[model samples]
Target: MPGSPAQAPAEPSAAVRSAAAAAWWTRWWVRVLAIFVASRVVTTVILLIFAANQGQNPWTGPKPDYFSFATIWDGLWYNIIAVSGYPSTLPTDGGHVTENAWAFMPVYPGVVNAVMFVTRLSWAPASVLVSVACGAGAALVFHRLLRRVGLSESTALFAIVLFCVAPVSPLFQVSYAESLGILLLAVALLLLVERRYGWLFPVTLVMAFTRPSGLAFALALGLHVIYRWVRRGTDPFPVRERVLSVSLTVFSGLAGLAWPAIAGLVTGSWTAYTDTELAWRAAYIGYVHLVPFAPWFQGAQWWSTVMLGIPGWVGIVALVVIVALYAVLLFSPPVRRLGPDLLFWVIAYSVYLFAVFFPQSSTFRLLLPLFPLLGVLALPRSRVYRVLMVVLFLAMQVGWIAICWGVAGADWSPP
Candidate 1:
């Protein structure tokens, strides 16, 4: 062996080097970061195009800049909260409550305010900064969530790509609490999937205020408990874990109601929060008492009559079809592969929306929370399908921005 001529050190072949490069690029974190950045760039261009054509509107002057445009719609509400604290007395229209800062949670603005204080940035830039940062965090966590649920690295990364380019993904870079809420939700869900029950408490509390999904999450947790109990024969739901899950569910429920209770205590009106939320829908259906599972029907009827000049029953039927489609998707192979925890979340969140939401232009934005569904969209290995879906999603960003985000003369659409 020693007498053999010394062989030159073998170098990695071209294919091996190329593969190493590809592997480095495809590392989970690296891919997620790239996807997040690329998606934001695409969304930013779309937003800028819309912003360039934006006429003088309630929120901005004609041809507003990127920050100005990004901070429009609910961004304006968030800005208001960031600058001035919530009103001690709710603003009213005629004799009823109207849209006010109470509808916007404190966590997002609170974070933006902190960023502003530390960085000496204005509300628009600070809010955008917070949003973008949280968007990045959400993207990273979402990849983890997907991988935790059995997706391959490629599928998980592709799911993140889809999530970043989603029509509502503009919220990730804009001045909305959505990115923050999503970041927290991704973390909470990852924790949920990992069975890290103790960490979920604080995350859930903060996420509740970040957006109004705590009740939905509580419902999901309750259902998770039931499912675990039912499967105890195999899954082994120990007493200690059961106690934690149950207590967390109750805590989450309390957290869901905490904002309303705070608003009531501060304003001397128990209905303060609900009334404020109703005010937004009042534009469509006029003053109406809150009724569980009624808003969607009412909203369907209102949109059908107003937009299509069609009978409201037709809209109700359409709603039924939509719900059916969603149900079918839930049971489909791709979604079922996401595991019961994520499935539980999607179902619970959809039920929550059905019970409380008034579907409108903002419905797309509200659906952002169901981001786990992106895994289904990412499941197809077809190159053409994947590429086409990305293009379609990008196009949807343009349409979503034009119809929902851009204010074009007495616009009723609010993103």
Candidate 2:
């Protein structure tokens, strides 16, 4: 036996190699990156398919390329802002304020302009790149947020999967500010869950400017303060934290209103921003004053009467029932798993939307901010359920793009 040649080390079997690959795929960052890339590929294809069918519209000629197609809708407004800053003299039609760049925030286009300055990339590429990068960042931060909220790693990853394939996920790779806003929100919520109040100041400031979320966040902070105070016996809301939280809430509220104030100061018109916003809804309900918690009811009535040919009161009653159902959902066991911080944010944001937003096609896009609820959907560990939901979400992405992103004749749907 000693004289016999020693056998060389055996190679790993196919099964062993397969298992090793599986293990590598299970690593969190690897999985996240893989999912993000794959989702982008899928979304890109869907967008290309739709872009092929595109007709001559306000945004592009027939069958425009991907970048041209992507930069349509709100992207065109952002493009205008990036190139030419908002007009100091508000544009009016027939002595009534018209929809203009004031309705679009500055931070997103500003960032895109900066990117173009540094990288020498054109508007479409640079804007889409920023959005895609922010979206990827959002997905990573979202996983951590889910973990912080006490979900398991697998469940958290599943939530990311659902997020990447959601109906509005096309916003991630387009020229929309949603990706940046979502990235900020995921980080902000993670900070809130960690009780990092001081850091939230800067995050809240940027978030407020990036999108219309500051006031809602402030409302959430206020609610969070009250909740902690009520549960202080067990939660122990310290005086330092209490003072800081209170200050942050006030700051956020001011930040929320800061844009409108800036718009007014710049245009020499006190109602510049609100007027511009109201103009978009004018096509449906005509010019109206900004009334808190009244727009949704108005929207319901208008939509019911105009579209469905039904009584307006029926729409109002239906809205009430929907609100009631949502309130019930907030207390559901799955939503409660997200903890008080996220739950409060959801409630406050929903209220803010109800108060300000007119229920329309854009309603789904506005609901993108409530993405934390995806965690609830991800809670079920059944493999079949997760697969089916992912399939459904992908299908919805197709429908959403066709309806909202593609411009038909006199298209009313906006993503």
Candidate 3:
């Protein structure tokens, strides 16, 4: 009996437990974390440099002691609304600017104001809190998505870092809608992974209401679901799922349109922003023709004034690159084994971004949800495919940073 049934060893000791926890930090993920931190620091430096070069603005400028500068143009107005709720509009052309119509969607500012009321924190600290919390949420979203895609913990950490600290990701770390938008986006992605299409609507509705960018995302996801169903010749979703998904997506689309629509009504018209655009959006149509191709414009223009923009040639190259790469990513082997389930969200995201072509909206920001779409192209099994992925990874990080500090989100004008 003694020879046949020796007892198993006891549980790990307290010291061993501590040692194992310490060892966990030494995993491959630790390297990824280190690289991510380095990337963030570099991006932060770039933001400071950009702020320093801005000459001066009495309202907003670099910190006096070089503490660090963050927040972009739209961030200021969002902060204003947070500090003091939207002032009663006095009527400009349509509704009054004081109505906060031009500031941004209400959700982020509402949070800012709520925090001020409850915690009695100032705008500066509150803004920082918004940014940090949202940034962490975005990181978690990427981590979950990467895990869903079967990436190792280390690679997932790298991607999460890119999403969190990379230059393009500053929006997540500021008082802007980017961070909140990211959290909802992550929740939506997780729901999608769980096949919880029912959540897509409410989540997307909140997202759409929170940020106009969310509308674009909602539309993209909606179309993707519809397209898959159409392709299958049978309803790709169960009857209840189909009804709920479509209904929610429809609601989201309308919710995005509602604020503008209501703003129009309040102003005794239905297109205040469009009117604002008409006064300044002359070349917008011509610009859309450049879509799915290259952005030929040198700098994005507002009020007939142009600023530096992404090279049209670069846009052309990036377009080709997006297509050629995603082509391979779309039909890879291991992923192919997972079939439609694997690509559902990616396809949805791509369709959403593709659904819009205008310059007035944040279609590019919508691309954040499409990160996985971009990752799809990197899914193949090959040396060349793998190398291309490395290049793409580095390029995305650099490109994001350029957009944040260098390109200046190109679309937004400072409040």
Candidate 4:
């Protein structure tokens, strides 16, 4: 009876497992990465459901048929260039085609075309695959770069979450240049930190080629290298590194100034989106007398009216905090070791966006990639603020998902 009474062993408790899971969540970055992965899954699910409901082929159909190269905005244009082979001139058919001011940026289209040439996959799948690769790459690169810049592992993860969950982040994974641009920016920052001035030059070339805004980074980085040369009084870097840096300096600056000219040369007019400031004029204000015709000064028209409200006030507060943090970071000893690479990129990115883009749209999709950089530069040591940043980005991602889902049902028909 005593032996019989000795029952089988009790199962292991989930409480211990739960405790371990809780600890895992507290690590900050793991939590942030989890959130990001989940958001993407959620959005992808919605897209799948949308495709199924519409009887659209997730594998193949019309342009954005199920979910391929076809995207709204510039994505459609690039897909066209990729599929049909780059046409020297778009087949407009005299008001038959629908194009937008934001539709042009030769680097992105050119790269997609290059991919098509090698892979020979039809435009749709190749474009989608490349987008996914670049987006994931950008996120991974940003995570590492932030870690190097003195961010806590949790803070860096949060930074990744911020990028992935931001309203514009989906584009990083979709058919857009932002994903590639972010990757390049992160790589450039890493090279800059290593003081591989020579290597930086080629990286600079890629940056300039990817986005016109890259020219600013090129100037800042080139100047830094030149200043280093003056300080060392002897060539400080390895010969190869010097070659890349010098070459990049030329490409970044020369290529930067060349885009508009190229566009004008192609279109027979300077009114191409890259060349024409009036292409999609919205919030811009002429600055002939002041800060010059920069995007932010121009973009002031967007928030100027909105700022008259409460939400605008919040943005104003956020802007002030960002600026103040930038100033403190300039002097903070803890981050002093990271040096100027990060600071220069932040300034260059912000300045270029403010100087170039318009005022109509508030989220400034063109500059959304800069948020992670902003978060890195402004990452507070406080636990509370870190949590807030994670929460804020999650909310933004959710909002964006909602907006995109709403668009799915529309006949916006991919170009």
Candidate 5:
């Protein structure tokens, strides 16, 4: 029998075949695409419903077309940059604030311009195309990151769904830098975690050009080096890896400043970028103050001077309480389940926002970069909990779109 041709392996059992099929369907990439598609479909449906309810046809309404809706606020500024270019001289009115194209980053507008050239479409349509495509890419990368951090396939998919339904997620479909910035950041982080040091440089560099959050990536890279060295002991990484890591940290930091440097060079003024930004801020605070928590103190003082003194003070207290609650959540059981790298980026980004950015109605949109951290919600397996979370996200998305983007216009907040 041994001398004879070995008999062919027996056919697998039906149960084994079924399990193999199931496993294939549950593969990480497969789940990621499925979740992304399903989420996008849901978002599209919600947008359509809202548009119809507003008596604005997606095709004919003057300001009701989806492209116009998506291309409002910052999108409009980006469009102007796409059609024209940055102004040679900053414009002002009555020695006060007016439009300054320099306040907007160039990546989104650049992409829109390229798209227009290729397709012969106008800026608005091109902007939507770039944003939606980048948004999809960001979702896929984010899902992959969740899995890399040890989530089960089901959990990772759920997290992607949550990200799509986030309150400010509409911004992802608009002509904004958030989608491209997040996609680049996710790529940089994934490369760093996988120890693909050579690839992190360009990815992080592009992220820097995409948004101010690029500086946060540099900080995250530095923190990553320290974390590895401390956790794994000295000389844990090979010499090449160590060199590449240090190079990326330094180069990405510089790249984050490249845009402002370019602006200054073009204008022949070192403070061109900051001056333009402060001009926009003048309407709110009238000046720039970098001291920590200055805004909170200023808000309290301003409230005291206003008619609703007690209520204003109470509002300031409420804001502090809310921030404290978020801090507590960062250390909660579910969030602790994330890997150290993920945790570090989330904390570093939040710190940057608090230290440098104003707290405004647009805060949620600004937080879109942190959406990946919401994957912690997937840690809980309770069906009721999952259902409740989805319901809450959907309700908040509807409310935000209705109040912030729908009725309020530019008077309330910049979408």
Candidate 6:
């Protein structure tokens, strides 16, 4: 009697069913979210401990309260833009540019304002909410991108941990545009990897308005298109598809220039954005020069004139070492391992940074966009190596937060 098809098995009881439902948390995204939350907790604790040790009461503030510490510096500017829209005319001091909202991009603040409108929350909380949510999305997209690029799941997840704990990662949690910019950049690149060029247009457009780093993405996509064209003898796409791809690439590159153009149009000056950026240079370095490596020469000359001692020589030597390290990294195996699109993007981005921007403590924050390159660390399969790197990353996070954000007064670093 029992041998007749075995009764096709009975349904599990309610307790067993509930247990199975709970087990659904074992999915990959669930794990990713868990790691993200845990990492944020660790970072927050570190920030709290350091702020306390520095005798700073994070709870009370004239500006950046405890809940709003992440919204300091440029983030404060974003808040202003969110609360009060950008002024039509730039503030100028005797024909020289002064601090203005034009320097900060709009997307981050726009989202914050929208959040405020919808939730009726204050600017600080709304800004932080936008950042945290975008940061979480970026983490998930980054993990997926790494896996899509052929890394094993373990390697991809490790890269995510490394990224979330990296020294500059606090920026991701802040009210700055880095979180939104990174999210857009990751999405654009992921779409490119999937060969969905048309979708890249809008994403890159939004990215352009988010950060100047959007130019890096546009260049990356353009280079990728050219790479494909060069290999056209074995080309996979038909003529129509190829034309569409090239059109998208060109459109994306143009979109990267749109924000600056808009700023120019708004201010009735072609050099509005550049002039505003140069104001900082004028204050710090006397005059702004358009020539490449001008900042390096100017920095060297200024250092030599000011220090006039072993400290001067040490500064020059340190500068040389940093430049040399960047050169080495340009061709390093680890950097090359970032694959063609990323390799080109990093190279173009680094060239732009070095050529146009002066090096400072905030340069580290600028390098946050290069988080994709951290995938190189995942190449090592050794447990000891991974453990050591994790330790180093966590330590650097503490150091960066303390030195750059805590100890250094405003204007020492842009953070």
**Candidate 3: where are CA atoms >4 Å away?**
1-15, 23-42, 49-54, 61-68, 83-100, 227-236, 276-366, 374-415
lDDT, each prediction: 0.92, 0.94, 0.56, 0.58, 0.75, 0.77
- Please tell me which predicted candidate would have the highest lDDT against the true structure: 2
Pull out the clashing pairs in model 1: none
TM-score of each: 0.94, 0.94, 0.68, 0.67, 0.86, 0.88
In model 1, what lDDT does residue 329 have? 80
- List clashing residue pairs in candidate 6: none
User: Worst lDDT window (10 residues) for model 5?
Assistant: 54-63
Q: After superposition, how far is residue 233 of candidate 1 from its true place, in Å?
A: 1.5
lDDT of model number 2 = 0.94
lDDT of 4 by residue, 153-201 (tens): 7667656666766655666556667767777777877777767666666
Which pairs clash in the backbone of model 2?
none
Per-residue accuracy of model 2 over 54-150 as CA lDDT, tens digit each: 8999978999999998888899899999988899999998799998999988899999999999999999999999999999999999998999889
Cα error, residue 152 of model 6, in Å, equals 1.0
- Cα miss at 294, model 4 (Å)? 5.5
Worst 10 residues of 3 by lDDT: 287-296
| Candidate 4 Cα outliers beyond 4 Å, as residue runs | 1-39, 46-70, 84-103, 110-121, 152-154, 226-247, 270-277, 282-291, 294-298, 302-338, 371-388, 401-415
RMSD of each: 3.4, 3.5, 7.1, 9.1, 4.4, 3.9
lDDT per residue as tens, model 5, 8-29: 9999999999999999997777
**Which 10 residues in a row give candidate 1 its minimum summed lDDT?**
25-34
Scanning candidate 2 in windows of ten residues, the lowest lDDT window is 25-34
Cα-based lDDT at residue 42, candidate 6: 91
* lDDT tens digits by residue: candidate 1, 177-283: 99999999999999999888999999999999999988999999999999999999999998999999999999999999999999999999999999999999888
